[model samples]
Target: MTPLIEADGLGRSYQQAGEAVVALSPASLRIWPSQRIALVGRSGSGKSTLLHLLAGLDQPSCGKLAWPTLGPVESLLPEKVALVFQAPSLLDSLSVAENVALPLLMAGQGRDSAARVAFALKTFGLLALVDKLPQTLSGGQMQCVAMARAIVGQPKLILADEPTGQLDQLSAQALLDALFRHLADSECALLIATHDPVIAARMDIHWHMEHGLLSCGERTAGSV
Candidate 1:
């Protein structure tokens, strides 16, 4: 099977008040098409740093990331890759449906944007609230709207950074279940950063980062 994403010796660092902080250590990783990989780690463990790199939202300071790395890479397309933030990133200024259609519009998409937005809203059971403002929804409902926004573009890769962190247990589980089920039926691959072992245990594989170093299998020893 072709690995949809590959990071070879990928590294990232930041300058915080003139002090260098190593956000991600040089690490190699791969995920095949339709693969669901969980990333578990404690706070400050570099999970979010890695998710950013994988999603092509940010580039590595050193090393390389190849798209469709495992096989048949035809072309590298932008927006075909997506990132889901921990918080509901919906625009309070736009209605839920309009918020969901932003990416498509940004990509210069046309009339079908409305249809695609409706489909995404239906998937997350947010169709009834399509005309509501983001600020009016409950936390879980807000996040559902955010998710509908993420998947409405037909992305091939989805990178989630503790997407359920702000959600209640029931809501978190429901969203995760829906996301994984989507991956199973579609050709997309997901790499998620999370603290929930209940969700991690259901993953195809997992990676734990510690002090900017990538560790496979079990989490950083003694991690929560």
Candidate 2:
């Protein structure tokens, strides 16, 4: 099968204090449809940098990245990819439902797409909070809202960074259940960057990032 995403020697760097700082070392990887990948790393380990590059939110400082499924595109399409950042990133002015619906609306889905929006909210157990604003929700509730928004558009690939960082263990488990359930239904690929060992262990494939380097390895029993 053609890979949904491909990266060849992809890397990123930034100038800080008049010296080049490598955010990600040259790394290559492929993601196919319905693949669940976990990018594990500690803070400042370049996990977010790699995810941003793969999502097409940032350009690689060197090398190449491509979405073969999208066809001849220099960058990814919004409708083809959904990214959930570490922060909730919800718009303060929009209600919870509105925020979740924003991506669909932006993708040119008409107002009749309310059913899709409702389903997403229901999936995340946020149906009652639909009318609430971001400020009214707790941090964990806000995270659920963010996840609902990411999957609402039904993007082919989801890149989530520390999605469960704010939630209690039970809420985190519920969120993961919803995510995998949706993935099983849609066959959309998921790449999540998290520091939690348990979260990484649950993914089908695990990739580790450290000091700007990336490595993919087969799952080992009780590996941390």
Candidate 3:
């Protein structure tokens, strides 16, 4: 089967005060349909940087990247690949329902956008807060809303960065349950970046990141 995304020695770096600072070491991996992957690392370990490159949010400084099954990089968002950031990233002016509906609207699914948004919110137990604003909700609620937005379009892949950082254990588990339910029997794949060992254990594949380098299988000693 064709991989949803494939990266060959992909890496990123930044110029810091006339010095080259490596954010990500050259790393290669493939994300297949229906795959469950956990990117385990501590803060500043390049987990977010790698996710950004894979989601086409940041340009890689080296190696190659491709979306073999999803399509071109420019056309991979809000339709083929969705992102849930560490922060909630909701528009304060927009209601919860509207926040969740934005992706569908952007994808030109305006006709049934409300229905889909409602369904997504319901999945995250946010249906009652549909009319609420971002500032009015708690941190966990906001994260749930962000998750609802990510799934509203039913994209092929979801890349989440530190998604459960602000949530309690129960809330985090509930969110994961909802996400897995959405992925069941579908081509959708999930790749989550987290420092939680319990969360990492839940996924089928575990990848480790440290000091900008990436590796599969057993995690490195003293990492995350």
Candidate 4:
């Protein structure tokens, strides 16, 4: 089967203070459907940079990337690939329901957007807070809403960057539980960047990043 994402010697660098800073070293990997992956790394280890490159949010300075199973880079957003950041990044002006519904609306799912939004909110147990603004929700609740928004469109891949970074241990676990429940039997692959060992252990495959270099372990079941 074709991979959802494939990278060949992918890397990125930035010019800072008249010097080149390597954010990520060339790394190659394949992300197949329904694969659960843990991108384990410490802060500034280039985990986020790799994610940004995969999500097409930033252009790579070197190497190649392709979505063989999905499509061209232009067609990966709010559908084939969804990215959830450490920050909830919710629009304060929009209510919980509205925030979750934004992706569908952007994808032109006009007629069924409301129903899909409702289901997504319900999946994360945020239905009661549908009308609540971002400011009114707690940190955990905000992150749940963010994840709900991500899955509303049922993207093939979800790239999460330290999703539980801001929550307490219990809250973080709860947030992950909700996410796992929603993705339990779906074909939506997940690539979560985290420093937490507990979080990393839950994934099927492990990828490590250190000092801008990336390494991978053997793949487990449910992967291509």
Best by lDDT: 3
Candidate 1: which stretches are off by over 4 Å?
A: 69-78, 218-224
lDDT of 4 by residue, 64-175 (tens): 9998988888888878899998766899999999999888888888678888898888877789999999999998788888889999999999999888877788877877
For model 4, what is the C-alpha lDDT against the true structure? 0.88
**Ranking of all predicted structures according to lDDT, beginning with the best and ending with the worst:** 3, 4, 2, 1
Q: Report model 3's TM-score to 2 decimal places.
A: 0.96
lDDT string, candidate 3, 25-94, tens digits: 9988989998888998778889999999999989999999999987889898888899988866999899
lDDT of each: 0.78, 0.87, 0.88, 0.88
What's the CA error at residue 92 for candidate 2, in Å? 0.3
Q: Candidate 3 at residue 167, lDDT? A: 89
Tell me how many residue pairs clash in candidate 4.
0
Higher-TM-score candidate of 1 and 2: 2
TM-scores of all models? Answer: 0.88, 0.96, 0.96, 0.94
